[model samples]
Target chain A: MTTWMRLMSNDGRIVFGRVENSYLHEYESLHAPVPTGAVLSLRTLTPVAPCAPGKVVALWNNFHALAAKLEKPVPEHPLFLLKPAESVIGSQQPIRRPAHYAGKIVFEGELGIVIGKRCSNASLDEAEAAIFGYTIVNDVTAAGLLNENPHFPQWCRAKGFDTFCCIGPAIVSGFDWRSARVVTKLDGVERQNYPLDDMVFTPAQQVSLISRDMTLEPGDVIACGTSLGVGSIGDGATVEVSIDGIGALVNTLAVSSGEAEAAAAVEGAA
Target chain B: MTTWMRLMSNDGRIVFGRVENSYLHEYESLHAPVPTGAVLSLRTLTPVAPCAPGKVVALWNNFHALAAKLEKPVPEHPLFLLKPAESVIGSQQPIRRPAHYAGKIVFEGELGIVIGKRCSNASLDEAEAAIFGYTIVNDVTAAGLLNENPHFPQWCRAKGFDTFCCIGPAIVSGFDWRSARVVTKLDGVERQNYPLDDMVFTPAQQVSLISRDMTLEPGDVIACGTSLGVGSIGDGATVEVSIDGIGALVNTLAVSSGEAEAAAAVEGAA
Candidate 1:
């Protein structure tokens, strides 16, 4: 007999899905290697950042559409960036941009790859071993700094605020790439949707390409570029990013914790 | 009594004043703090790097003169950066720019601060406990991609290659910054020479500023800014960055290791 955890019902029987009017850890099971006819529940949580001590490496735009928008050549290699770990929030947390930012907050829906091991000049085969799991990340942005400083040598300060990067739930290992689907929903309407395999560089290739220049340590998460349907999102909009096999991550819009607490109090009243 | 090390003659007698050229280790001591009024000599081959391994954090133009050269704002707060550790080289090496690099090498002389303790969100006084000592670094950079891209974000490919970052000697705990100085010489031409106290932010202040946003780990190195009289050197030139109290760090200029090796062979023949 195998032991699996599931949410419970009022009568004490195990519940296979979400419980009504409460927070209960609900889950389903599946075969490791599925046949074409096998069906699995889409209840897995959105992937959160796995790094505890590792630096957050963010890529600008390794996508074809974004490249076309900028009229720049798609890079032969991934352009790397550093976002200090201080900027991360959980999966269901509100994406916050303080009044000081005053810039538009844009969302870039990306497939986040979590590193499982320490690596330097790693090979493609070695990179596979280092991948702990995968998740979806809404790579939030301030969206106006690029235009403000055309001559700046680096952009760490502009992109590095306390809540610039958000990730969550747990990591899902054994993530297969073929036919994976990703969708972004805004206020209950689907805004962007695309296939995971549409990327110019695959996850394995990104790892191999990046390790040539920088050494990747354990718990490092690399966010592959978002697909088409990416546009700016203003304040006060609920943004949910979902993957086919993985569950949906719905986070509301709020400027600060004060606003979030006020909204929570209103929900309790109703 | 404490047993200390000093450079010794081939016959085992202690060598004084000048370090025997033949006895210098093959590896370079790229960036290391110099003890005030002490001649630094390696008694044992200890590997030294410009910054510690947690991440090579650099502050862009913590001094005003550098911000003007790049035509950037003297940042309201300290500007921080990550230079890949792979770029490090020892003192005996020359800064290398290969044919592949194609005239992309630039030099930045910074006072290197070595962290001895783990600290995060540290206050001004807390920063003092985190610092182990200081060193000097010639932050050698590759400019083509960085100049071509929106911002050269890849310090690994641009500045993190082998031998690109240099340091030296051993760590010395105490030095009065009020009277400290830094000097840079290219082909012995003396391009930059300035007092360390002339920095826009002090070493303790830089550490304190970073800790407010980051949890600095041990072995993490910080490169404080270079002074005025900065310029480029490559193809073939000897570059030296020296700090008063710290020993002189000398490296010949080529674009990279292959070029450095070829230059070395040519110099060997002469």
Candidate 2:
């Protein structure tokens, strides 16, 4: 398997590279990665999300284990939501709590499928061919805002805050996902450990099914739904979502002073 | 007041220009439009969406008339959904029906707020200053797919299809939305006639309130929700969403032969 990464060089230029040992061998592009012979130590560069997605489509409940736990039947299709690109942040970036919302913030770790080509109404085989690689995603959300209004479910708003979607480290191509597992930890304590095979719809099925609903562009990411052990996070808590083939995606919840002050005010009022 | 438009020149170059009587005066950029002394006839160029939005945030039940008609209370916060950038299409572009599903596709005509600068946690006054212009939008949706699953409301999937969001004609700066009315016509017959003043949240208020939820980038669009009349359009039907200050955005529904064949197959199976 090949591991690809995107990072900022010491000279402050964003470049794509192949990760090996302690060095990142520079490459021209993700689709056509021809080595540029400019090798840099991995420590000298800052890693970013392996791909810059035009859009991020996230599944709601695509895992059989989760569906069974919730007592919901298997969905006929992939139920999904579109998260704004503005909500994306690279791994190691802070997941900032919205100052205006003094509510419970949660962390959900899931496997993210990175699309390499433009896809629309693609067949299952075409969808399989379109999958470029895989990465880890921490779909951060403001849990309290989800069901606040009974009339409409605020899926986008509850999860579309800045720094809410964390993706990164590297994108691993040709990696076997069926036998791998997604392991999530909070402050060194293992919170979630689920097999990727528990997914109701495989990555290819998701790509094909979702492509019929909307066009999936190059660098677009489809985050497979999370299973059990989804829970809230406290301020300054660190979250790490790891898949064995793809490296871990680590992020910390950063509750700003303004948010803390607002929370205090709301608590005082209450 | 300035009317800005984007178009594909006959020479096959994408150009931004100011719309005058029957001509387009070319400009260098949308943010700082420096005239290029190249004037082209309006009929010579093909018009596209006035601005390429990074993301489109659309409201729901934001109109008093619609809220009262549906017997729902006015929301404390804006109920919004994010439409992917790929779904955006210009006026005169055909709205293609998804081939996999034969569902009731509805049209919603609403006022669109174009953002001029990156805004986050903005005050009401700052939000007012950040408003670059207004435009007309036909927020198209597959109404039948909205609540297909009783548990999950597929707002994004139902409305995020390719060419589902039509925006354009021109972006008019300094337009008076309060005194304006959105007028929609389906195949030359008027259907929707609603006052913009009946909105629960004004443009500035929407910007300020939503910025608190997520960062609003330059060229981001906020679509004020539609009111009263909303109905599905048949294949090949023409739709025109118009506001007084912004020109009318007209498009026709183009159902592909593949969709017709699939519909027939489903009917035959039934």
User: Candidate 2 at B14: error in angstroms?
Assistant: 1.3
Top DockQ hit: 2
Candidate 1's TM-score on the B chain:
0.74
Q: What proportion of true contacts does candidate 2 retain? A: 0.91
lDDT of 1 by residue, A1-270 (tens): 111112223444433222222333343321121123422232332323333435666776677776777777787777766665656665677766654456676776767777767776678998887776676677776667534544444455554555666664445677675578778888878888877766777788888777765567666778787767766666778788887654565666575666567789999999
Which regions of candidate 2 deviate over 4 angstroms? A259-270, B259-270
RMSD per model, one decimal: 10.1, 3.2
lDDT of 2 by residue, A1-270 (tens): 989899987788898888899888998877666799999898888988888887889888888989999999989999988888888888898888898887899989999999987889999999999998999999988999999999999999998998888998799999899999999999989999999999999999999999998888877899998999999889989999999989899999987898678899999999
C-alpha lDDT of residue A188 in model 1: 76
Cα distance off (Å), candidate 2, residue B45: 1.1
Candidate models: Cα lDDT each:
0.63, 0.91
Q: Each candidate's chain B TM-score? A: 0.74, 0.94
